[model samples]
Target: MTSSSKGSYTRLCIQVNLDKPLINTVKVGRLKQKVMYEGISFLCFYCGRLGHK
Candidate 1:
């Protein structure tokens, strides 16, 4: 957990399949956090494949 001026937060790393629908946010009880993709490359939204746009 990391603490800042606002509050403490936990960072999460989840592995997901590129073929499935992308998740935008995660909700736990009443707290919802936006999901951001990092270190992802060669993704084509048109076909949901890598390196063949």
Candidate 2:
């Protein structure tokens, strides 16, 4: 797969491994917005914000 697709897949895997209630509350659009606005590498489910690691 392409690097972009691979990155998305990895993000999905990380999200799945996190607590259900954390990710369930926020809509996908909000997550995208957080990423866009903050220009971060990933959206953190636990803290509900964009972060880089």
Candidate 3:
């Protein structure tokens, strides 16, 4: 497969709605951990940085 296509499959993007109430810190932390455990890269929507859980 081409690099662009491969990159899309490997990366995981999660878009959180800003209109919703803020998620609890503990819950957010757990979510990140869960995503990491799944072996997919997480990208931060706000800062545009990769999340390291």
Candidate 4:
């Protein structure tokens, strides 16, 4: 199997219209997973950031 250099097994990226509000969660099968950003140290604004949650 081959993989793209852009994403990981647990990660995905897509181009979206910036005019829309960001979605917090996405449905993965039956479970909902929160959307996350990378490279930040820590934060928790309803959603969590790395090293904080």
Candidate 5:
């Protein structure tokens, strides 16, 4: 795992592999910000663009 520093946000990179047909993989990551936001943005490596709850 590795992390890149951004001015306002931090980009996290993780690696994993899948074992089952239905399951893709398992990834653990975190995003830390000074203030709370209304929307959620997750650029998933497997599924791609994930937003909101």
Candidate 6:
């Protein structure tokens, strides 16, 4: 099997359209990033972004 390119991975972002009907076979994911200041970092569960929760 062949592997997909790394550029395609970041470009392929998923989003749900509320205006359309909900589909059963769809996949979902979360966006996240860690914030660091002077060697200190924070973590979050909801949405996973630092301090966004």
- Give the TM-scores of the predictions, in the order they appear: 0.50, 0.22, 0.20, 0.47, 0.17, 0.21
Worst 10 residues of 4 by lDDT: 44-53
Question: Candidate 5 — which residues are off by over 4 angstroms?
Answer: 1-7, 19-53
Rank candidates by TM-score, best first: 1, 4, 2, 6, 3, 5
Relative to the unseen true structure, what is the Cα RMSD of model 6? 11.4
Best by lDDT: 1
lDDT of each: 0.69, 0.41, 0.41, 0.58, 0.37, 0.37
Number of clashing pairs per prediction, in order? 0, 0, 0, 0, 0, 0
lDDT per residue for candidate 5 within 1-53, as digits (tens), equals: 33874365444443424231222333436633342223335534344334422
Whole-model lDDT for model 5 versus the true structure? 0.37
Better of 1 and 4 by lDDT: 1
- Candidate 4 regions exceeding 4 Å error are 1-9, 39-53
- Poorest 10 consecutive residues of model 2 by lDDT? 9-18
Locate the minimum summed-lDDT window of 10 residues in model 1: 1-10
Error of 6 at 50 (Å): 26
lDDT of 3 by residue, 1-53 (tens): 66666332234456655445323233444453222323336644344345542
Candidate 2's TM-score:
0.22
What candidate 2 gets wrong by more than 4 Å, as runs, is 1-41
lDDT of 1 at 47: 62
Model 3: lDDT to the true structure: 0.41
Clashes of 4: 0
lDDT of 2 at 47: 66
- Candidate 6 structure quality by residue, lDDT tens digits, 1-53: 35763332322235534345333232436644332223214533333345432
Candidate 2's displacement at residue 13, Å, is 22
Misplaced by over 4 Å in model 1 are: 1-9, 42-53
Output the better candidate (1/3) by TM-score.
1
Candidate 3 residue 15 Cα shift, in angstroms, is 0.7
Ten-residue region with minimum lDDT total, candidate 5: 16-25
